[model samples]
Target chain A: MAVSSTALVDEVVADVVDRVRGTLEDVFAAVAQVAERTTAIAAVRAAGRAPTTADLAALRPLLHERLRRRHDLISGIGFIAEPGLLGDVPAWLEWWQNHGEDGLRPLLPDLDPGTSAYSDYTHWDWFALPRATGERAVAGPYVDYLCSDEYSLTLSVPVQHGGRFLGVAAADVYLRHFEAAVLPLLRRLPAPAALVNARGRVAASTDPRHLAGSLLRSVSGRSCGPIPLTLVTALPAPRP
Target chain B: MSKLSNGALHAVFAPVGNLARVDAVVRRLADAIELGLLADGEQLPGESELATRLGVSTVTLREALMALRQQGLVTTRRGRGGGSFVTAPDQPRTARLGHRLADWSTEELRDLADHWAGVAGTAARLAAHRTEPEDLVPLQRSLEEFEAARDPAARGRVYGRLHVELAAAAQSARLTKEEIRIQAEIGALICLALGEDDARAAVVELHRALLRAVRDGDAELARSLAERRVQDAMERLIGLRLTVAG
Candidate 1:
């Protein structure tokens, strides 16, 4: 009986991890498509000369179509240009997102560093990590007041044109929706379990003590997928 | 403050929880516009929809919009794709801030300062325990910006951003959201005290020291430094209030 129960626990944990990985991979796959298209456009534009802001802005319809088609998982999608990549502008982000029944809407963040309201995207992990590492990244589970105001995870891929870094193509996934999709699988575990991001912040958890957004103290866990997320389970306390 | 897109929708449309619903709505909307959560010339949701989102009646929202218009923070259009639009206000003048400060008692200011200190100190402690060195980069950049900022308005923005980033480094979304909300309420007022070069320099030094403590993983030191930083700023603000009163 004991051996059977242990095997059952392992099976449940594997199932939850699989589902979590599958859901995130879907989002990343969508963002990867955006990055590929963006890179192709940038390469074409850069071949003639450095891409103009107008050149990049022309990609809006493409982004809008992606947002419309993937509205269930993708809350926002856009490209952020490397500073001075577009010549005149120090920084630029051309982003669009679903707006309930209104379809897609553009985001307008202040790019000027001098202003009190400026949002310097260079400082954010979602942009910074991919830029520094030249790799895809999952940046949050944090309240993203900059784009979605929802607790969200941002998936992003570095966009490069002929070995030159242009910027990044990114998408936002609302944490509530992520939880709604994953919680049922987590509930199958006999022990309390949590899904945590790279930094140990809980993304979703069956344990009230380990609420989403809180940090998980014990770092031991199984990596869920290509991403750095971990599935951490806490064994029930021994009988008193 | 508002960044554009769906985030702005959340900030602008989140329910107002105050008993004085109209006044609360007016303050919330005005704050959103001033903070740039609502872009200049951006159209607000239609009245009934906005009312439903805010959990207020259309009559109350109308009254609030009227108050916002009177303050020059919003403009309304009549027909044919007409709706209320945000008119971003200029930076608050010293005289205007003085008048706003006059509304708060010294005791209330002290209470707010204590609360602010508690939040910041706890966040710093958590950050020290949780954050990687690379995660501190934004805080470092913010400190450098604070040092370089010549004016109080710019310094105030850097100062508020540092604390918000500190909360984020702690990996607590609730704490980060709270920090953002608090900054919106007090950020403009902080400019009044930061106008002094000496005060700005002192803040820069304290922030630098606090960042170092967090980097070293000295949680206790980080907490005390954060608390001291808030208390010092509170004293400067109180002194400014007294001067304005006199």
Candidate 2:
């Protein structure tokens, strides 16, 4: 029974890992398609020129359409241009919200990312991770302090044009929403179980002791590829 | 940590508006004890310390403790190794449980059920939204106790404590206090209704489903389950009332 329980937990973890990776991959593909189809983004790539106000206006509808399509799974979606990539345009940030007052809203006043009020996104994890790793990145199930104190995760896929890195196209998912889809399976296990990130922080756990965001001490489980998350049948016994 | 030691319970210790000091102290302490926030046989602070903490006079605290003693909910010792101690609560008889239900008309019972449904639904929703895995430990433990308890009063206390713990997981003191109040009011009735072993089994299964919903962070489903549980309990009580009347 113990062996089967352990195996069952491993299978569940592997499935969750695959699903998360697949979801992010789909987001990456969607962003790539959006960049190719939108005149604003496409024209910049084709003409090898900086984006203009007209380009932003053209991109807004496309971004909103994409966000509306994924509204059920995500709260917000954005395309962040690399700082100074658009010449006089600074970095264009356009995001669509599905939360309160839902609809498309520019992070800046009047489609301008060059304003003094809008801070630089050069250092942000969503931008920095993809830029640095050149891989699709998953940021957090941590609090989105800048947006709201709600638990959230950001998935970003690097957008590139001819080997030159542009910015990242990203989406924000409220962690609770994601958990609603994932937690049922974990709870079905007979033994205590948890999904822990690479840092050993729990994303969700059936074992009440291994709490979300709490670090797991010496947890043993299966961790599959693409995502560094583990599914453990049992956490290490508590310190004496 | 003992529930009394929770900083959140401090809100109940505050003087209730428009209530006499002794009455308020009695209500607060009784409510706490009934809700399992004051565990059985746990030692309470010295009278002077408790009075200071509650912001009430020592005389009022003494009066309140005396009243609790009279009710068999508290015990006091005079010598060393002494302070006021909570009594191991007895299982209230079916007669006592039914007596509270008898006082309420069907309409009053319905209204109370309606109010309870809203409170329970909100508590479940917020608990699912805000609770961490660790936060649900108390709730899970309470459910296990409910399942294992053979005594009807023990089952009822554990049942009520489950909801109170869910409210605490919501991270809102007001909701937690409100849940405790509702639990105290409805506990006896639920106990009477769930006395049959089959009824108790059904409630446990429903509780398990509700726990799954909360664990999964499905706030809507959690709220629905909680509301349905309350509605079902109220219906059971009303059926019992009608049977007795007929």
> In candidate 2, what fraction of native interface contacts survive?
0.00
Question: Residues A1-240, candidate 2, lDDT per residue (tens digit)?
Answer: 333566675665566557655655665565665545443464555576676546656666666776678765667776777776665665566555565554555443222221111134565567787899888777655544234335666777787777777777777777676676557666655577877766566777777765675557566776646655677766777534
Clashing pairs in 1: B2-B36, B2-B37
- TM-score of chain B, candidate 1? 0.81
Error of model 1, residue B198, in angstroms: 3.8
Tens-digit lDDT string for candidate 1 (A159-236): 987788889999998888788888888878776788988877788888886678666655688789787799988633
Q: Which 10-residue window of candidate 2 chain B scores lowest in summed lDDT?
A: B1-10
Candidate 1 stretches with Cα past 4 Å from truth are: A1-12, A101-103, A216-218, A234-240, B1-96, B125-130, B212-228
DockQ of each: 0.30, 0.01
TM-score of predicted chain A against the true chain A, for each candidate? 0.91, 0.78
Clash pairs detected, candidate 2: none
TM-score of chain B of each: 0.81, 0.65
* DockQ of candidate model 2: 0.01
Which RMSD values do the candidates have, in order? 5.2, 22.1
